[model samples]
Target: MRFMTTSDKPENATGGESAADDTAEVTGIAAQDWDRASADPQYRAAVVDLLGALAYGELAAFERLAEDAKLAPTLVDKAELAKMAAAEFHHFERLAGRLTEIGEEPTRAMEPFVDALDGFHKQTAPSDWLEGLVKAYVGDSIASDFYREVAAHLDSDTRGLVLAVLDDTGHAGFAVEKVRAAIDEDPRVGGRLALWARRLMGEALSQSQRVVADRDALSTMLVGGVADGFDLAEVGRMFSRITEAHTKRMAALGLAA
Candidate 1:
């Protein structure tokens, strides 16, 4: 599977036209320059795939968090997880709306990603509250980093929307605090949780590979030699950045990366 990275330089146009004009022609959406960029056939197809993947991801996150809330040791923690789950659902709704606005059926768009994401959750189901907390923080951070990298390739409006939905919802800080406090209470947990974190990363990557392999349009948009495209080196750098961010998040939880 090939990955694409975000270039530090500005995105170039496909032809002589600006990225905005290209998007508007392809996507048929009348939002902004970024939205206009969605009109490009490849770009529009990739955007739909992106939105669908994101919508399903958020929906699955909501369900998983809600389940995790049941394992919370305290009423307060349970409520907090529940709140986070609700927030995920809200993001899902926004992405679904965007899909509809683009003349795509939201359910159809999300359908292709369902199995891969579901398999990920099944493989990495948390056994305890602490494990759940770590997954919430570390797993979500990795996914968010990836989406942010992809957003860099998008037009301004579309980029803004992607960034907006991927924003941290305070769950990261909460998970970090809780996991750190737990480790402070029992040092042995640090080792176990660190191993668990590794397992989560592996499972997520496995599923991600499946998604990328299945979604040709999305993959082409990222790494194809089209105008404003990303090269393999850029993709390597993007993964490196994601790894660095994941390591930092693990450190924040007082766990080894």
Candidate 2:
């Protein structure tokens, strides 16, 4: 396993101070309202795909968090997980509402994603309480980062909704605290959790790529086919930023990246 030192923690992966200015100037889509942006059929299709994937993801997070709560060692932990699960469900409702508002059937929109997302959950099922916590933190954060990257290129109204739904449901600090405590009590646990996190990382990234690749409209929107969307190089940089953020998260849990 690779261990991260203090110096290895890079700057915040969300581009530096000028990222906002850069996005506004470069992606003309960033400034437009959804009504104006959705006039393009391809962009509308991409947004539908995006919202579908996110709605299902939030729904799944709710389910998984509820199931994982059963493994919590204390009532406090269980309650915290339950609260987060409720928040996840709320996010799901918002996404589904947006889909309906856009004249898309929520079930139909989310159908295309259920299989892939469910497969990810099955493959990355946590073995124990600590593993579940790591999955919640590391796995969920990676997805959030990807959505945030895509949101930067989206129109103003859609970007606001996407970012709002991706908000952390209080899982970050809770997971970090619980996982670090477990590691502190037993140093050997860190290695196993680190390995588990790496597996989650691989599966999550693969699922993300597969989701985009399977949807032509979404893939086109991502690869510069839409208004100033990400070029290939930007896609690479986005993944790098994601990886860096994962490393920092692992370090926060006192685990090697």
Candidate 3:
């Protein structure tokens, strides 16, 4: 999928996007030159695919985190979650600035993956603090990993912006404490949490496939120019790192990993 930045309705550019079905035109600001890759269609497409995905991801993650904050046990904990959630919006604003600098509306740039990315959040909505941490720990780790991959292929300025939003430890301590306490109250919670973790991995993997297939440029950037080039080895490495981190956090909470 070639995603060219459009301040004008991108999804409605040719009426082929699923969103185009509802509105004949996305109808927003005029298209501008928001990308450094404008000199080449493939390059432009690649950058837009990266930014579009990143933008939508930030927007969606913020909303999910904000809602999930309500699951916290105390007002202080809730405020911490809210604070972390606000970081996503700050990221959105930073990304939107870049999009506008190059001449694309943030909303229009993010419209393409509206369904797939948003769908992942809706289906994987957290029910409580543990689930919320699973969402943050597992979800943020993978997203940051992917961003690191694509950012490597870009110029320093753009890449720095991308790298700046990597996995945040913003509320990991609180989450760890909460998860540990819950498990301590009921030892059986360990089994349920492990199972829940597996389910999270499954759903995340499924959604990742959708993202890889939907945006070829993104896939290329991730896999060093081959669509399926990044195999189990790379993913296993990410899994191992995240798992180790989770294990340590769990141990800190007196929960056996």
Candidate 4:
């Protein structure tokens, strides 16, 4: 993924910075560029909130996938899940660094999202390996789509960062293949997995609404508030696009959306 610019150590760099931070500073464009681009307070706040939410979401996904890896029936399956978990962690580290470079405390930026994300995970905990796979595929796809949609409204640098981190590293195909093969072997399992996917979607939508309500700036930007702001009709159309994508993904998994 392409990053913006590389910069020297922030004169205030603490020895405690992680390797991800070091790598980001070396590869990323100078922080001053981001600061200048986000001159508008509202735009800056929305961008910060968006990055924070994404950062926290990736971190939570990493933890959840790692836990689900234990449910894999075979060593091969476990290894695949572990790879996905690692990918999520890599995305999280990139996002965290971007947050810091933009002058936001990564932890503080992510803190507000903890409850919303954690609650969604708790509510949609998988019952078995199949359910977990479906959750990973459907849930992550929805998130990636949503971020991609929002990225269109962002400045070039921020949009590049968002799109880059959202790259799924081909894990969606892995999940879809595993789930579809399992269903083919046991026809009845498809019904159960289909129902689980629906439940995941519902829980995700609920949590997303909660996040929007809690983050005014981010919500505004999402609904077209960044420049001219999106009208209700356009927002409806935007959601329709998201729903259409979800339907196609579900069909790929041989499940109903």
Candidate 5:
């Protein structure tokens, strides 16, 4: 994974940062003359395709999570998830703007990878509220780790955008708690959720492979003895972390991981 500037700090997120400055931070990425990069054409296409997919992924995630938030059992839980979902909408707008600043039409740029991401979601759509939380907790976190990896390849503004969109621990924790609560109500959910989580991972990998197939600039094949962007090792490590979290969540609900 390449290292780049990403504003993961809470202060740099939507709350403290001026909305107008978002344009400046994004413009910094545009300053880099992408046309000058002499990387493999496939590699460049790969990177763009990945970013485009993530850009649209956030958009779809926001819509789905917001709708799912209505499943919250209590008014407070409903409000909390709904607010988090709105935060995602704001993130979607910023990412879309960054894509435009980088010289790509947000919608058009996102088109190539749409099938993969959307298809992944469709195949692994959660069966129940607990499964939905598991999907949110696992899927969004993995995507964040991936985003951080890509941020390394971008300039400061792009890096900041990537970091800004990362899921906050607080929100993820809330979802985790919700999942545990549901599971505690019935231990049988343990096996079901585990399978659901695995399905999510499988679907994610399937879409990811499709993305890496044509584009080499992002995580191109072993190029010059090194993969360009994302690699299995890094993804595996991320999955290890996710697995740990999943285990902890399952234990909290009185089940084995």
Candidate 6:
């Protein structure tokens, strides 16, 4: 997947007039700009927390992908992962820059999320190249789905940035192709990957809940204290959607969900 580099500039979050209008309509923000929406300190805090979590996620993804590359069986695979790692780092830069633009220090913003995310990586460390690929695809997608659910309720600018940064980093298709090929070569691999994916699913969901629970602003935003936040019913439905997507991705990878 193509991605921005250091020379590339960030998108103008303010320029997506039609898209922003649609999001604003859905979220009941009525086209409120970030300036107006951020007037509320709680909402601003939520945005900061959201950006912080996402920035750190991208940075971690970059690191993980680079390390996973060392396990590649071929030079082509290594190069491919390197490219993807660069893309993830590019995404991190965008998020970090956005945090700075919004008057928050990037490192400080990401600090609160470091322990949770790092602990997740430690607990769910993959044993090999295939497992690493599975982790990147399954684990990252779950996080993206959760963020997308929350993004639906955010103001236009923040929503746009969140969605943009969550773009696929060539991992989904790459993982599916590599994993299915492996399973085809030895069908027993399917069972192993299936189990690995299930473990990733549980851990990812747990971390997601933990992160939100630890952040009052984020939790409040998700549970309806902020702009058009989800009610309890919708929160349940959101997880259902995320799980459904996970099942589909696992099928694509030739693994049971």
TM-score of each: 0.88, 0.87, 0.73, 0.84, 0.71, 0.87
Q: For model 4, how does the per-residue alpha-carbon lDDT over 122-175 read when each residue is reduced to its tens digit?
A: 999898888998998888888998888776656668878999998867779898
Give the RMSD in angstroms, all C-alphas superposed, for model 6.
Answer: 7.7
Per-residue lDDT, model 2, residue 239, is: 83
Stretches off by above 4 angstroms in model 3 are: 1-38, 167-169, 226-257
- lDDT accuracy of residue 86 in candidate 2: 97
lDDT for each residue of candidate 1 in 19-114, tens digit (9 for 90 to 100): 333343222222236455554677778889999999999999999999999999999999999999999999999999988888999999999999
Q: How close is candidate 3 to the true structure, as a TM-score?
A: 0.73
| The 10-residue segment with the lowest total lDDT in model 5 | 11-20
Off by over 4 Å in 2: 1-27, 226-230
- Number of the top-ranking candidate, with lDDT as the measure: 2
lDDT of 3 by residue, 1-257 (tens): 12212223245332212212233332211122223335545556667777888988888888888888888778987898899889888888888888887777778878877888887887887777777876676677667755664554464466677888664747565666677778888988777777676677678778877977888666654443332244445445545665676556545655455
List model 2 lDDT by residue over 1-257, tens digit each.
00011122212121312132333333355556799768767778888998998999999999999999999999998999999999999999999999999899999999989988999999999989999999999878988888877886687799899999988788998898888888899999999998999899889878878887789887766653433444576567768988999998798888888
lDDT of candidate 5 at residue 5, scale 0 to 100:
25
Model 6 C-alpha lDDT per residue in residues 1-257, reported as the tens digit of each score: 01111111223122221234333212333245688677767777888998998899999999999999999999999999999999999999999999999999999999999988998899898999999999999878888888877776676688798889888888888988999899999999999989999998888778877887799887776654333344566567768888999999898778989
Query: In candidate 5, which residue ranges exceed 4 Å CA deviation?
Result: 1-47, 167-169, 221-257
Off by over 4 Å in 4: 1-33, 226-230
The CA lDDT at 35 in model 3 is 39
lDDT of 5 by residue, 142-211 (tens): 6876666555445444446677777483567887777777777876877787777767777877787687
